[model samples]
Target: MMFKTDKQTLTDLNVLDWNSASLLRFFDHTLTLGGRDQLYNYLMHPLTTIEEIVERQETIAYLSTVNVSKLFDKYMMVDLERYLNKPAAPSVKNRTSYFLDTISFNFFSLSAQREQLLVRQSVREIAMLFTALQDIVAEAKSSGKAVGLLRIYADFFSANASVFDKEEMRQVGRGKSWRLTTHKYNYLFRGKRRPQVQELFNMIYTLDALTAVAKMWNEGGLCFPRVNTNDTAAALLRIEGLYNLALDNPVKNDIHIPSAQNIWFLTGANMTGKSTLLKSIGICIHLAHVGFPVPAQSMETILFKGLMTSINLLDNIGSGYSHFYAEVMRLKTMGEIMTVDNPVVIMLDEIFKGTNYQDAYEATLNFINSISGIESSLFFVSTHITDLGEIVGMDSCVALKHLETKADPKQGAIFTYKLLDGIATEKLGMWFLNRESVFETFRAVQPRKSSS
Candidate 1:
């Protein structure tokens, strides 16, 4: 029951790439290697259960309410990870080796001092982090919500509060000299205390990742989606005020696909926001599955097994796949996936665009005909083939919709970016070409007939 999505779908949704337009880039606020890795892990694999998703959302919500800015020093935690990952010589407790090690330390005083400082920094950060964990626990208890993750960390902290509260640690930061602080940390971290330090480091990594999620949720004013996992097959998706998170002033629109209608046939002229709408839906599904707040005023949808999208298809030069062949292969892959029993949400933009109009129209119509019967999943297909809507609209399972546009005569076409029922019959392509004087330019570039 693992929540799944492919690399192509991720790219289509603009999720993971480091480009400024990626969804991950917009939400990533991690300051350490561990935190960044953790965030990436979550994005790659979303939780599959209702309870886990809600628990995670509650944990993020509670965290967003608290300002734990001083809990962990970003630089110190990064250096701590670096030090821990650094290769180390195996300890040799024999008397001969001990004496040799002591002599080696004398020769490498500068290196020893640097190592001591690293250890001191680690101890200070861990201590501050432990205190921060306790504060979160208090907040969780006060919130009266089921903050399962935070409570687990709080319990672990409570069980080991003694080691952190020890007199040696109390003197760690109070000492005036770096050598003295380092010696105290070294003494306190010996034996069982070493494992305690490791556990605290792990907690810091988890908290940092959570903190990044919470910060984004708060800043974006994102709301937790009402995920309906009860219907495992053919569930509905209703999102109000949905918009692209990457855009500065995006036009929000509502979308709804009742259980009776699973396939959405969207039609609109270019720049009418059809692709953006598809992307927004995909992003919302992904973020909701990740247990983070979504970029919408409200969202309620069925828990899909996975999301599959084909928006940005490209030719495979190395594989010798033409653009049309590549698109066909991608659709073939989706067809194969649909055969499986698990439910999935499928999205395709301008399918079969690489081929001629006759073939593209026929192929797209056949494709819609084949998938319209799938009752265990949802389908969203955006295309300029408005005729397909007429044919597909006859099906009870298909919903025909369009993003409407208006011609301003003087200002040209004014795009509303609003979703509406019924198919689009507007033929604005020629209008746009005429407005741009494309035919005049072509005429000017032609050879003169007078020469003949």
Candidate 2:
């Protein structure tokens, strides 16, 4: 089974985008276009099984210790890929046909001659790429790190070793005896061994993607998460020192949501890092499913069937829906998912914020009450209405938590940005208004007695 996610969840977490600041851009250090595409595919489809996820994690962990990037050149790989994908030309039957074809190309057709030259360049590129892979395999074996995906690649290269003979490739690359050996080798490569060559390039591209992920792991100081495929009733998510990667200096927070307390009713004031914390959790969950290292010191989680996040949701103007309606629809979708998929992670930031205060409070309270019965799924609901916390706090399944904020005489409100136990009682809305001088500015302007 594939891990379940949607565009809204992906957009909420900034998972895949062309923007430089996106998570995809942050981890994409692949050397070739095909490699980048492979990386994108990895991000798009996260694994559902713990075994598959662990295997990928081990492969990347091994890659992080080695310098495989030094063996590949982006341009050369790109050229080789283009050459392999090109349509193969008719092969000459014998030496007589080869000689005549060469004569015809050289004398009559400039385009044919140019094509032959390009083919020779492509042959050299392929040979160089194969040699690089050979070295990589040798390095992996000598280091005793050739296992999992690396071992598979090594085995493939070993099985096809005769085809990519170093001496023959070297001679063919040097254009030695073009009339005889070049045509024979070209026929062997482009005609007879095309499928194998394509398979080799696919492996190279996969390596490039994994190498990029490994680089991210090493550079970001990320840790591989321990994923368990237990019953949904035993779902658990615990992470220590977890923070958002986009921030230069993010405040790390510890989160622990055991199966008993499946829902966390979060309360915090505005700008108290609630949204950032939610995004960080969602990002880590998604990365864990991808078998990629998460931006955390350590983590242990059960394999979740699905993930959904409702943050920064917009109104569907074309569909004649207001923001509140959109929020309701999103919640409906999440509810539908929860019905079939147990152990799904659902995150809602400031639920029903687009509605009136009374309606928001009632809706939030009722929603929490409704979802608290679903003990298998995990829910993180952050809201400004701390009153609901007092009600939901009594529930055995609801964990009441908040981002701590302290009041300062000089600074007005100093946000600690720390996750703390208990409901938040602080209300700093008026303080924010005064600190920004919003009322004072209005008083000073006074609308200039517009009646005159």
Steric clashes per prediction: 0, 0
lDDT of 2 by residue, 3-75 (tens): 7799999999998988876889999999888889899999999998887888789889888887777546788
- Cα deviation at 64, candidate 2, in Å, is 1.8
Model 2 misplaced stretches (Cα beyond 4 Å): 91-103, 107-109, 158-167, 170-179, 231-235, 446-452
The list of candidate 1 runs beyond 4 A from truth reads: 86-104, 142-146, 158-196, 232-235, 446-452
Could you tell me every candidate's TM-score relative to the true structure? 0.88, 0.91
Error of 1 at 335 (Å): 2.7
Ten contiguous residues with the weakest lDDT in model 1: 183-192
All models: lDDT?
0.78, 0.84
Candidate 1 structure quality by residue, lDDT tens digits, 1-452: 57657999999998889999887787778766777777888888878877878888888887788776565567877776676555432365543453355346654688887865676676665555655566667667676753858777767766877656644444554443355455445444542356776777776776778789899888865889978864552347888899898888889988888888888989999889899899999999998888988999988877778888989889999999999999989878877876663578888998888989999899988878887777758889888998787688899998999998997868988999989999998878999899899999998896867964
Best by TM-score: 2
Error of 2 at 155 (Å): 3.6
